[model samples]
Target: MDSLFDVLETNNKAMMSIAITRKGQPLYSRAIGYSWYGPVKTQANTKTKYRIGSISKVFTAVMIFQLIEEGKLQLTTPLSKYYPTVPNAARITIAQMLNHSSGIHSFTADSGYTSWLTQKVTPATLLSKMMPAEFEPGTQHKYSNSNFVLLGYIIEKLEKKPYAATLKNRITGKIGLKDTYYGGKIVAANNEAYSYNWQGNWAPDTETDMSIPGGAGALVSTPADLDKFMEALFAGKLVSRASLTQMKTVEKGFGMNLFVFPFKGHTAYGHDGGIDGFRSQAAYFPADSIAIAYTANGVNTNLNNILIGVLSIVFNTPYTVPDFKTTLYKTEELDKYLGVYASTQIPLKITITKKDVVLVAQATGQSAFDLDAVAKHQFKFDPAGIEMVFDPINSQMTLKQAGREFLFTKEK
Candidate 1:
C-alpha cells in the first residue's frame, strides 16, 4: 500500500516495522525508518528486536494454560496456595487474576513504582510494597500489571525453574522463535530496536527492571519471531485445542493476560503494549486465518490507526482515517466551552486549555491530547481516534472512541 507508506512518511514516523501472514504463510513484510537517530544514522531491519511491552502478557498466559493442561495447576486455585504472604491471598483465585478481576491495586499505578524501578527493586520486594485490594476480589474488571507479575511468580514456583528458562523451554524454544527472549543485561547482538519518545527528539528505549515487571512486560522480539510465535500458539503446538479455546475466549476485556478486541463483526484477539518508549501490537483473526505483528520504536505515533488501515486492506473493508481539520475560532467562542468536565463512571476529568485538551483517568496520570475542530461544536483527537461532541444545548460533551462512549458534565 503506497498510500500507507505516504501517510507514515508524511508524519515522519521514527520507526515502523510490520509482518503479515495468512495460514502460516508470509504474505507481506516491511521495515522503514531509522533504528537510531544521530550522525551515525543506523537503519532498522527485520532482525531489529523491540521491547514488546504488554504483548509479553500473552506469552505468560499461554505458559499458564499449558500448565493447566498438564494438571500442574488449575485456574480456580487460590493465590494463597502458592504465595501466602500476599494479603487476602486466600480469597483471590487464579482465574480472577487471569481476567484482571482480582481487584488488587496495580504496582505500576503506584506513584513510587518508577522511583523503585530506577533503583532496581527485586520482584519479592516489589510485591511487598503493593497495598491491599482496591476492592473485593472479582467485584469488577480492572487491568493491573501486578496480577501477571504474580502469575510469573507462580510459574517459577510450580516449575522449579527461572521464568526465563521456563519460557524458553516451553514456548519460545518449542516454537523455534530464534530472536525472542526475556530481556536482561545482555541484549542480543543486532537484537533490539532502540526506542524513542516524542520529545521532538530520539532516545534509547527504557523498561522496568525485569525483576519488577517480569511477566507483565519484559520480553524482546522481532516482528518475524512474533508472527512465528502466534502461528505456533494457534496451531496447537503449545497447548491443547481445549486450552487454546479457553485462552481465546473473552472472560472480560482482559483475559489470560490478553485483551480481546471483538470489533468490526470479527473477533480479533491480541494485546497492545506500551512501555516508556516502545509500543507493539500482535493480532490474529481466526476466522480469516490472518495474523499481523507490528512493532515501533517511537512512542505517541498512534500505531492503532496504522493497524486499522492495514486491516482495511487485508479484510477489504472501507476504512478511512478521520480528518482532523481545524477551524479558526475567535477567543470568545473558545471561552464558552472552556471548563472542567467530569465522568463518574470512569472517574475521568477533562480540562480544556487554550492550546490543548487533557484527560486524567483513574490510575493513569494526565495525558495531553491535541484537539482539532471538525464542526462548530465537535473536536477529534488526531492521534487517538476519539471524538468529542459538545452539546451546547445541554452544556455537556460526549467522548466517543473505539465503540465506547462516556458523557461528561461541565463543572458549575
Candidate 2:
C-alpha cells in the first residue's frame, strides 16, 4: 500500500492523504502535499483538516437517528412539523430526505450559487433559495444538499442547541475526532488546507460559506479521523445497531446518508464529498472488517482514477501509476477552440474558453471547469469522464461521456 503512494508522488504532484484500517486497527496511513502553499509552505499530514463536503451528511443522518432512538423524531416525521412554509414541506418525510427521494431542488445547482458562494447566508435567505420540488415526494431519488441542510436545522431544533455544540456533544467528542467539526474560513495556521485546482499551478478553488451548507456539506476533518468515524459508527459506538442498519438500507443507489460501492464482489458502504477543490471519500467493508479514507486538497487528475488505484493497491491487485504528462500550449493557440458549441441531440450549449494557457469548458448556465490537454485539439475532464475532440478546420467537436458520443458544431 505504501509503495503505490510512493510511486504516485514521484510521478504525480496531486496533494492528498490516506488512512486504511482493518477491524478498527490501522493498517497504513500517509499524507502528501502542502496544506498551505504560501511564503512558508505548510505540508499536509495525517492531522491536516479538509472540508469533507457531503460526508457531513453521514454525520447529520447519524444524529437524526440518535433522535429517533430517543423518540424525538421518526423516519416518517413530516417536514411540515418543522418548516411548513417550504415548498411541499407538508408532504416530505424524514425518510424521503434521507434517501434523497424528497425531490427538493438543490440550491447549489442554482445559477447564482457561485455568485455568493463565499458569503454567509442567513437561515431565512437560504430557505428561499430552495426552488420548488422537482417531483412528488418519494417519487424519485435525486441527491439534494437542501435535504440534509434542512435535516441539520431540524437536528438543532430538536437538540435546542447550535449544530456545532450538538455535534461535539453527540458525535465527534464521543469518537475522539478532535479535527472534525463545522468548517470556517480556510485557516492554514490551524492546519486546514485551502483547496486548489491544477491551473498552471495549484490555483485556489472557490470556498463556500459554512453557514450555507449546514449539515449538507460543511465539516472539516482529516483522513485519519474520517476512518475512525466510520469504524466507530459501524461498531455501534455512535448509534444503535438498528439505527445503523436503517442508515445502511440501500434504495435506488442511496442509503440514508450513505452510498454503496462494489469492489471485487465485496460491498462497501460510505460517502464521498466535494466542496471547493477539496474532495474526500470514506468507505467501510463489514465483510472484510476494513475501512479506508482519503482526502484530496489538490487534484490534477480524475478523482475516480485515484479511488480505483487506491482500491487496487489495497486489494493487492496489479496496478500501474499514471505518468501525469500533458502537452503545454501557448495562450494564443487556444483561440480556435473558443466558441459556443451545440449538438442536435442535447439542449445545453457548451462554451469553450481559455485563461492564460488553461482550456476551459462550461455548459449552459453552469460553472466553468478547466480542461487539460491530452493531445492536439483533444482535451478531457477526467473527473466527469468527459472527453472532447475538436476539429479546428471543420469547426466541430465530438463530445463523449458515459460511453455515448455526440457530434457538435460550432455555433455562429
Candidate 3:
C-alpha cells in the first residue's frame, strides 16, 4: 500500500487531502501541499476544511429525507404545494428536484448570477430571479442549482427555521460532522482552507457569498467529516431503508443526491463538487467496503481523472492515464474530414484541422482538442474523451462519447 502523502507529493501540486476507510475502520488519512501559497508558508492537515461545493447537494438531499420521515413532505408532492408563486411549481415534484429532472434553469447559467454571488442575497430574492422555467417541469434531466435553492426554501417553510439552522440540526449535527457548515454568515474560525484561483501565474484567494449558493454549493467540510457523513448516510443513520433506496434509485442520470457511475461490474455511488476554484469527488463501494475522497483547490484540472488514477493505485488495478501527447498530422489527412458537420436537434459542431480538432459545443463552451492517431483512420483526443471514426468507403466521420454521437458529412 502506498502512503497517501507519497502519492499526493508525486501527482498533485495543489493542496490535497484524502481519507479512505473499510468496514468503518480508517485506513488512510493524510494531507499534502501548502494551505496557502504565499510569503508565509502554511501547511495543510487532516483538519483543514475545503469548500465541498456541490457535495452540499448530498446534505440537502439528506435533509429532505429527514423531512419525509417526519411526514412533513413527500417525494411525489408537487412544488406548487409549497411555493405557489413559482410559475410551473404545480408541475414539478420534490422527487424531480432530487433527481435533477426539473427543467428549471440552473442559476449558474444566468449571466448576472455571478455578480449577485459577490454580494449577499436572501434565498427568496435568488429564487425570484429564476421565476421563468427553462423548460417544462419534469420533462427531462437538466442539472440546476435552482432546484436545490428551492429545496432550501422548502425546508425553511416546513421547519419554520432558517436553512442553515435546519441543516445543522437535522444532518450535520446528527452525523457528527463538526467541521461542516452552510458557510455564509456562519463559518468555522480555524482550519478553513482559503480558496484560490490562478490569475496569470499567481494564485488569488476568492470567496462566494454562501447565501447565493444556498443548498446548491455553499457547504464547507473536511475529508474525514465527509467520509463520516457518507457512512452515516448509507448505514441508515440518516434515513430508513426504504428512504435510502429512494435516495439511491437511479432516475435518469441522477439518484437522490449522488450521481451513479457504472464501472467494471461494480456500482459506485458518490457526488463530485466544484466551485470557482475548488474541485472534489467522494465515492463509496458498498460491497467492497471501500471509500475514496479527494479534494483539490484548483478548477481546470479534472479531479475525476485524478480519482481514477488514485483508485488504480490503491486497488492495484490496471489503469493508464489517457495520452495527451499531441501528434502532428499532414494537411492532406486533415482535409479528408474537414467540414461543417452538425446535428440539427443537438447543438454540436466539429471542425478538423491540420494542427487540432475544434469542437464548438454550445453548452460547454469551445475548445481545440489535439488529435492523436491510434490507427490509420481512427483518431481520438484523450483529454476530451472524443473519438473520430472515419468511414473509408463513404469518406464520412462520426464523433462519439458521453453516450451521444454526431455524424459529420463531407462538404464541398
Query: For residues 229-348, could you state the per-residue lDDT of candidate 3 as single tens digits?
Result: 888888999889898888888877788878776566666688988776777877788777777776766432334555666677667788765433444556665666555555454666
Model 2 regions more than 4 Å off: 1-13, 327-342, 345-378, 390-397, 408-412
lDDT of 3 at 80: 86
The whole-model lDDT of each prediction reads 0.76, 0.89, 0.72
Ranking of models by TM-score: 2, 1, 3
For all predictions, the C-alpha RMSD in Å is: 4.7, 2.9, 5.6
Which numbered prediction scores highest in TM-score against the true structure? 2
* TM, every model: 0.80, 0.89, 0.77
Which model, 2 or 3, shows the larger TM-score? 2
Q: Tens-digit lDDT track for model 2 on 1-412? A: 6665665566445788999999888888999888877677788888889999989999999999999999999999999999988889989999999999998889999977889989999989988988688999998899899999999999999999999999999999988999999998888879888988765567778988899999999999988899999999999999999999989999988899888989887889999999989999999999888899999888766778778888887787778877556679999999999999999999879999999998999999887888878899999887678899999999999999888999999998
> What TM-score would candidate 2 get against the native?
0.89
lDDT of 3: 0.72
Off by over 4 Å in 3: 1-13, 185-189, 198-202, 320-412
lDDT of 1: 0.76
